[model samples]
Structure formats: structure tokens, C-alpha cells
Target: MDWDKLRIFHAVADAGSLTHAGDTLHLSQSAVSRQIRALEESLNTTLFHRHARGLILTEQGELLFDATSAMSRRLDTAEARIRDSEEEVFGELRVTTTTGFGSLWLAPRLPALYKKYPDLKIDLMLEERVLDLPMREADVAIRMKEPSQADLIRRKLMSVHMRLYATPGYIAENGMPESLEQLSQHRLICQNVQATQVSAGAELVRELLTYDVRSTLTVNNYFGVLQATRSGLGIGVLPDYVVEDFPDIQRVLPEVESKEVPVFLAYPEELRQSRRISAFRDFVTEEIIAHRKKMRQESESGA
Candidate 1:
């Protein structure tokens, strides 16, 4: 099998048009067609179906395309690893995490990371859906639960709990709940039980709903709940980590909280030696350590 011909076939399959693939490869349409023909002959299979509009992949073509796509992603990972400079953490680091944690915690601390590594390029992908790390869908991930993917080097970051919070102004006007039974008197703000979230949070919301709450405000994400709570809307179910950054948000019925949700940071084992990964891992570990220390100091002083 000729490497060049396979490359051309991959391009043609990707573009679905011989002319478009030729343009991308900077080759003439006839030359591109010749290579595709050669590849098809070598494989002894009809790779595509010719149509008036564009090329559609045959079953064999789909299999080949899948293989080529994996190759492309592997090449990209290799390129990134090769580009990582020794003794310098400069290059793109694609980090994925839930929107709530990314926006609330990690994003706020990224300035520190940028200051230390000025040339570092960070592509933060925030969504609830877990990306495939081994497939190179993302470079690293910070997730609410431990990642069960094989070949991943994972580190437990910290644990978070869903707790009730309310702005001081709201508490001042509505008073505070002395116990879980008293929560029925005030409106509840939380993530909808049906939305995708940590199981503990949804369980907590389900348990809270049983209190016969008078009013309810349900948002899909914690950010929306936090915003509503900050606006004096109602008592919100939020993670305890927010307390450090939002001192004005007072804990309500501190005893009423969800089970602990463990947070983990994971990356492919292949990236273990990459300087960028080491830098990011160290930075996040240092930040979590500092956060724990500060929270302890505040607690001691308050005690």
C-alpha cells in the first residue's frame, strides 16, 4: 500500500469530493483521482459510490475512513508532544471539565497559571459530557467523579458537597431556616433533578423536595442557581467550594447537605512525560492545596 495514495484517499473521503480534496492537498483534480483509483485497486474494493453531487463512502470506505481518522488524531497528539519545549511549558493544553467547576474554580485561578507560563495556550472545554481522553478528544479532564477510563493517569483533586446557601440580603428579609423541616417556608433554588449532574446533587434535590417547599426555582446548572441566589431570589443548592470565593453567600441549615462528590484530574498515560501536562498538574495541585489551607485558616479564626 502506497502511503501517498492512502493519504489522498483519506482526504477524498473526508471532503466527499475529488476536487475539494485536490484543493486541500494542493494537487490537480486528475492527479487526486488517479491516486484514489490506485488505492482502490490496491485494496481491491470499491471505496466510494459516485453520484451527481459528491462521493459517498461505501462500507469499505467507512472502515478506511475510521482508521484514517484515528491516524489523524494520533498524528495531532504526536505533533503536540513534539512541539512541547524542554524546560518550557509553552503549547496548547486542552482542558475539559463541567461548566460549573470550570467557570467557578479553575477559570478564576488560570490567571496565575498564565503568569507563570506566559506562552501557555489553554483551550478550556466546559460541558457536562465526558470526552474521550485516550482518543485525544481532550488533553486533560477535571471531573466530578473519578474517571474510569483505562490508560489514564488520574489524580484525585478534591471533594465537593451540595449545600444550601442564600445571600445575606435574602436571609435578612426572609429569615433563616433553623432546621430541614423549616425549609418549607422559603423558596428553594437548585438544579433541576432531571438535568445531567452529579448523582449526589440530584439525590439531595430529591430529598429536599420532600420537605413540601412552598416555591421552587430550578436551573440546569449551578451557575444559574448561584446567580439566582445572589440576586436574593431564594435559598440555593450549591457546592461548598463556592463559599471561599463568595463570602457573602451564607450557608443555610449547614447540617442539610448532599453526599460528598469526589473530583478527579485525569490525562492519558501517554502524556505523563509531557512538560505541559506536568506544569498544569502541578499548578492545579498547588492551587487545591492553597485553597484547603485558606479554608482551614478561616475556619479556625471563625471558630
Candidate 2:
């Protein structure tokens, strides 16, 4: 019933130490300990199991901690919403995306974004794992495929394909392959078939392996594959998005490529009106448009 006791209990449970919680709350250890005791007495249940090392949450404490954690996330979301301004976009925006795309594409363009919104704090989480948007694990995601999660405001950004690429140096060292049959002479650099990635990319790599290829190198993500390929390690199968920024890497086997993969941007439906979300969404859209225009120009000029 006492909000102050609940607050202290949450802090202690989070820190797993009364002294640490006291330090955070700017209260003495004795004061924090007394508050915990009072809360336990009021609830008539043990919230923590005291130990010499620190404190462990009891079953009751685990339940309460879960509730408090959810509350904390909700409060954070509320704070973000309150900070959203019509005239300015400034707040923490947790953005999640595949490591390859995040490092190769998004991260490079972030300087411009920071220049526009000097106060924005972007926590860029680069991993393949899909974070829970509704639960506030992350605020937005730009994924290789459409997100299937519920309660998300999804937008299709673009499509990409797994195509063979090799630096001119690599091609000079290992003679260019004229066809699928000729690929046997060169090493293949790509994501492992079992790695978490787009199925089309894995399928293309599998098909390439069917050839009489002798040397091969497999990385867990496209970023590593790109690096290896750029280093003249071998020919790499990478997403088409790289061609614009990495002009020195030439596309190989014009006739050979994987099925197209759709890219999507998604955020919680609750963030549909958020100014930060709008700013990010518009920024990405504008960038994609510019990329598309450049790609078209390159294609036209090459043709």
C-alpha cells in the first residue's frame, strides 16, 4: 500500500543489495534496510533471501520484480512520449537492425541525423535477433524482411538481393569466373548456410557450393563477408545495397543471383504519433529514395 516502500523494494531488488540501493536512493543503509523490513512486515511475506554475498529475490520478490520491471518500461515509454515535441525531436530512440545493414548502411548515415537533432540519443542495437517492440525491448527495427509481430506499424522500405561481388584486386588475383562452372577456380566468401540470415541468400550460397568449389570461407554476418571480399579474400555473395557505397567491388555473374528479399521498417503501433519515430521514418525514407536514385543512375549509365 505504501508507494515509498514499493519504490525502495524495487530499487533493492534491482541492485540486489540494500547498501547499493541506499546509495542510489541517497539514503543510509539502515534507512533502506528498515524500509525493506517494513514492506515485508506489511505484506507478511519474505521478499528477499539475505546472503553474505548479496541478496537474492525470493519467489515473491521475483513476482514483484516482474511487475516493477514492466512498470519501469511503461514509465520510460510514457516519458519518451511526453518528451516528443512538434517543433523538435530530441530523446532516446532504441533502433534495432541486422548487423550487416546497420553497420554497412545505417551507421554511416547517422552523422547527418545527429547534425539535425543534436540532442538525440540513439542506442543502435546491431544484431539479427528480433527485439520485442511492444514490450519496449527496442523502439524501431529495420529488418531484411517484414516483421510478423503484432501491434507494429510496419512500412516496406526496399528490396535487396544476394549477388556475387569481388574487388577488382581479387578478380585480378583470381581470374574472374565467366559462369557458374568457372566458379570452381575461386574461393567463395559468404554467410554460413546455418547462420541466421535471409533464406534467399542461404539458398544462393548453397547453389554456389554445389559447383566444384574447392576453397571457401564462411562468416556469421554479411558485414564480415563484405570485409573479406573487399580484402580480396574471395568472391562474396552480398546484398545489392552495397554497390552504391562500395563502387570498387564489381558484381560477378550477372545472370546468377538470389531471389529478392524485402526490407521493412517497423515500430510499435503505440508509437505511430511519436515525433522521434516520424523523424526517423522520414529520414530513412529520404535516404532510401536517394539510394534508389543513385542506383538508377548507375544502372542507366552502365547500360
TM per candidate comes to 0.73, 0.73
Candidate 2 local Cα displacement, residue 100, angstroms: 0.5
Query: lDDT (CA) for every model shown?
Result: 0.93, 0.93
Off by over 4 Å in 2: 1-84
- Residue-wise C-alpha lDDT for candidate 2, range 195-257, written one tens digit per residue: 999899999999999998989999999899999999999999999999988888999998899
Give the local distance difference test score of model 2. Answer: 0.93
TM-score of 1: 0.73
Best by lDDT: 1
Model 2 residue 180 lDDT score: 98
